[model samples]
Target chain A: MTYIIKGDGSKEKYDEKKLAKSLKRAGADKHTIEQIKALVRKKIYNGMTTKELFGLAFREFRKLQPIVAPKYDLKGALYRFGRSGFPFEALIERILVFQGFECRRNVTSHGKAVTHEIDVKAKKGSQVLMVECKHKSKEHLTIHIQTPLYVYARFLDVKKEFTKPMLATNTKFSGHSTRYAKSVGLRLLGWSYPKDDSLQSNIEKYKAYPITMLRGITPDLLERCIKKEVLLLSDIHGKSPEQLATLLGIAFQKAKKIAEQCKVCELK
Target chain B: MTYIIKGDGSKEKYDEKKLAKSLKRAGADKHTIEQIKALVRKKIYNGMTTKELFGLAFREFRKLQPIVAPKYDLKGALYRFGRSGFPFEALIERILVFQGFECRRNVTSHGKAVTHEIDVKAKKGSQVLMVECKHKSKEHLTIHIQTPLYVYARFLDVKKEFTKPMLATNTKFSGHSTRYAKSVGLRLLGWSYPKDDSLQSNIEKYKAYPITMLRGITPDLLERCIKKEVLLLSDIHGKSPEQLATLLGIAFQKAKKIAEQCKVCELK
Candidate 1:
């Protein structure tokens, strides 16, 4: 009967299994997962907010395994995107580019009935993609069915120009929306949507962690990095901290800390 | 050169030719048009608002030919629709039903990608129409190109349920929107758009004036009538003033005036 307050001020029964499942999905080893669960159980109290509970778990995971901690909090990093959703769109474009797709962001093209401001357009040899990025900053909200509905509509308008339609998101998709998308051959990539290839898997496979996940940087700094098109950890993989400090106009120590965190996340 | 302040607070040089053309379109006789033109010329002053000029013209038109005056001020009456755009949608549904189409208002149907709340869905034998009502309360705003784009996208989603997509509005369509709609085989219906089959022609041909055009009732009463599904003057064509008063909970004199106005508008 343990109840926890959710981010939206609603109360829900605290479920230990859900936290364990999320930790597992974050690639935490079983031993570390057990230790985190023990710590969370000891700290669990009535009327605690879910944010506090997750923060505790994330801290413990970071302490136990620094390398995998970034991945564990990847969803949180994605949530740091601003309300405009532009940074999320840019991140999707960069991720696609890392995967060998020639990608363009914020592209405008005429559809059959009207012009569309496509978030990301990618092409690889014979494959062309019209990717719509639906970014929600809140954790509980899923990509609804209406998105793919309108997205498919936009694709139908510009199908002559693009070979396929894809919807990318930072969160998961509703069951009905996923089924509808699957039925129409509309590809979906989200936190945990499609079985094998998802937003998480794509980022993990290429180690293209969003710059927001780096330690010792504020949201404002992350925004400037996004504006400078430095979204991925790989974007600063080889650069020295001094170079990053000059590029981002930040303190040398803050840049060094971010650089160190990026190296840790990029570890094999 | 007389400058008239438009509804949007932009100033424009007054054109007598445009006034005459609008009067002619409202079914005014040449002699009456000449008299209204003379009156407008006499009243024209620098820095006069377009609303004031139109009020003078509408008043003169009412005195000369009261029957056609409602049609002349039809655009203004349409602009009285609330920001929610529901009443305008109801008006379009009534107009379609008058034209022998089996019409349904606010119909929800599942498209391939999602469910859409269509403003008006009309059916005639094998011909099915999915109509989107883009009602604008502002007089200066036109139906832009983006509307038909999304409407067509929704149509493509539900094309299995509907034969064609049609965009209807109380205002005019921008030239680019009209051309884009035409090129994509999307039907366009708006004020003075599509020549013979425009919304104005349809209303005049069938005399299906909106209840908002009735002189006696206020906007609150018009909203109440819309809530009671009384959008068209034809809806109250045969009802006596006493019965209308009983149904609408309004004063008998107000109901009588509305009945009298409907009679005048419905005159062949």
Candidate 2:
């Protein structure tokens, strides 16, 4: 055991079990988790900050599994989806697919009063849902009550079509906003909202890591992928590097590296 | 009549009747109109721009009828309401009063799903109204369809408390926005909408000029007046210079000048 300072300035003893739990949450296999733990343990010193400790483990994890390493910094990786919210909406559509929902992105629905360009219209079984994706680039920001207010009002305008409304964000939700949304029965999903079920949890469970997580993916390249509807790692899974290069209009070597990263993120 | 360049870069013969008609629209008296006409006619020369002719007319009109001169540039004066929309909301409240409606400014009303801070809520007889005031500082910008969609959604949320909803703007509304608002039975008020009963016509008919139309009012001073709920030119009408100075925290001489200007805008 080693004493370490946390991100919030609190000092505590670092245990290997805690490190393994986080890796497990990122969907690392037991063997890879042990390898990362041993690699991190060698770099530990008294009073080392958790950040420095995380950096050590993250580097070695990346070398071992490039695909899963991005998942280790999942929150940071998601932030790379950029500010437009289109790619983030694309990610949400894929996650909904894992939940057995058929989705149409950017649907223009005529409401009771005016027409609205909905982010996503999802249909699961016999129920249809209105999904509003709110993306923020910064960390520690909270979705306020006004968002849910307007979102629920929008859903009400198209009530004849959508049976339920869901608000998904890259950040957290304020307590008041959460309470208000709950009272109105509007589903709320954020980084760690709803305890066991959240945007992060759903992404992990569905293995819907975005293509932006790949090492060679630049923002411009990621945007191109989003435009081509190749948002998820699985979307390019099992493709030959030559095929990826032709499909995405990239060089073969770059496509080869991205394809290798996508392999590990493939759902069994 | 000398040929003069118009604002649109086209040349036309200077028509005294056209100049007088505009002054009449600004509520200038017949005597003041004749004085400005004579003043502009003397300054006109062949190839002189209509802008130069109007400048001569406006300067003389200001000397003759200080209060009504601001109305000659009514659209430009309204643009000084600033970007905050608070003073504009205050103006709307006063205008509603002129139409026999008892109005409340910035009322927070609870809705079925969320609470909304309404700009102005008016009640006349058994009917209640929800008012949204949209103020733009730029010229020629139109309120698009999205505004009415959200405004009507907000109204629908609070429909039980209000019988109808009205949208008032300093600029014009796009044709699609107007059609959407009208189809949904929502009232649309702009610089010119709904034919004769537009915002400009109402302001002229009811003499509800904003305090910003007054000369010597700085942006900072106007903000102070808005905070004090002194929005209309009539709000300071009939007040002594000393009273105006104390109410607005300004110089005695400035207040005296403002008070003199306010006298002409007093409602009959």
Candidate 3:
């Protein structure tokens, strides 16, 4: 079979049949050659550039080699999972940052009490949260049997006020295992593929807002805003922000400001 | 913060603060509880239903755990790479099937010459292709070293006439390693995430088509198709039946028949 290279190479046409023959001669089985041929045939489009096609064909043919398969599969799986856009660990850090927390990944702590590498160390206000992450195939089960050990280790290292330990998995946990986690006071979080609504909501909720919104925003500033009636927080049932803002004779921002103040006041 | 319990539950109005305190009492970290509360606040719409927020919170929380973080991250990567929609191995198999071959996944073989479990096995006519898929993290560099052993093992198990060994990985190969593989005549396929079209095209070039296409077809028939211009036997180019049949002025069944016949003829 002849292949017309579609990319920017000078040699635009090559005999794929010859290539297969060469591969067979070079120790590729006839079946493997045929497989290669079929693959090439299925994907070639009209007006495809030669360089592109050759690169594509070369990579595909390479798969028949033993050394490249595992890494290829891992990379493939990673891309499928959306980690290709950004380093997965980095994305986690970004999410943590957006959530109004400071986070560190792959942190190790060593002390007389414990020795462990935490996937993430997060601080919100006075609380310190240690996070561990595991990425494995479905056949590999995830259990946070080491949570207590890590907690103990962290206790030895920082001696900060301890918060509950956190464990996360892409897969679901066994009922008994989850119960065990609960029994030990470890918090468990599971995330599956195709970001579900609840997860998305969490992401959105924690996302950082624009700096303009932060103007004069101190923890106690909400109290002043509420006292001055610069905003009014009310239960306007089933009203859109625009509708409610219009009814209250305020800008959406002012209404949102009022809501924020109310929340702070309520919390206090 | 008040929550409402719906249906079958004895309680109607439940206090959200009470629930948060209970979770805190249950050993949930303050940060996690806060994250959960934010998640609930963002998602709770008018007429918001039950207080199953704890379960939702638990699910979200699990993704952040260390022991399981890798699994979730990998899943996200796989989904991004387009493998998460199906069983992890199925995507690999599908690519092989697209090359017009009968493919099986996760086959175990044990023999004096070969003792290993192969991730995929593909057959076309007389040729048998053994594939091993390794999904590894940086922590497991050993996966890269294992491919050659797997190939050698597979090569030993099958009679020289029937078997061909292949490897697929998501990682890039080192120069020295690539040279070593080429020296041994092993086929190596590599893919990175984010679905590089070029790489995918390369993968497509070597992928085997579904075995069903070979039904009622013989190697001679395929050769005849090639000779008679009934079907084009090109290397992995325009090979998908749905695409090829239309261009060739034949039904996919007819094209498949011709191709299978060619496969049979080639085997002879």
**Candidate 3 chain A: worst 10 consecutive residues by lDDT?**
A207-216
The positional error of residue A257 in candidate 2, measured at the CA in angstroms, is 3.6
Clashing pairs in model 2, backbone N/Cα/C closer than 3 A: none
Q: Pick the candidate with the highest TM-score.
A: 1
Local lDDT at A73 for model 3 = 26
Q: Among all windows of ten consecutive residues in candidate 1 chain A, which has the lowest summed lDDT? A: A259-268
Candidate 2, residue B243: the lDDT equals: 96
Q: TM-score of candidate 2 restricted to chain B?
A: 0.83
Model 3 per-residue lDDT tens digits across residues A97-199: 6667788877775432234456778788987777655443342344432333333323333344346566554445555445545554555555432235222
In what order do the candidates fall by TM-score, top score first? Answer: 1, 2, 3
Inter-residue clash pairs, candidate 1: none
Docking level of model 3: incorrect
TM-score of each: 0.78, 0.74, 0.23
- Which candidate's DockQ is highest? 1
Error of 1 at B3 (Å): 4.8
Cα interface RMSD of each candidate: 3.7, 3.6, 18.3
Clashes of 2: 0
* Candidate structures ordered by DockQ, highest first: 1, 2, 3
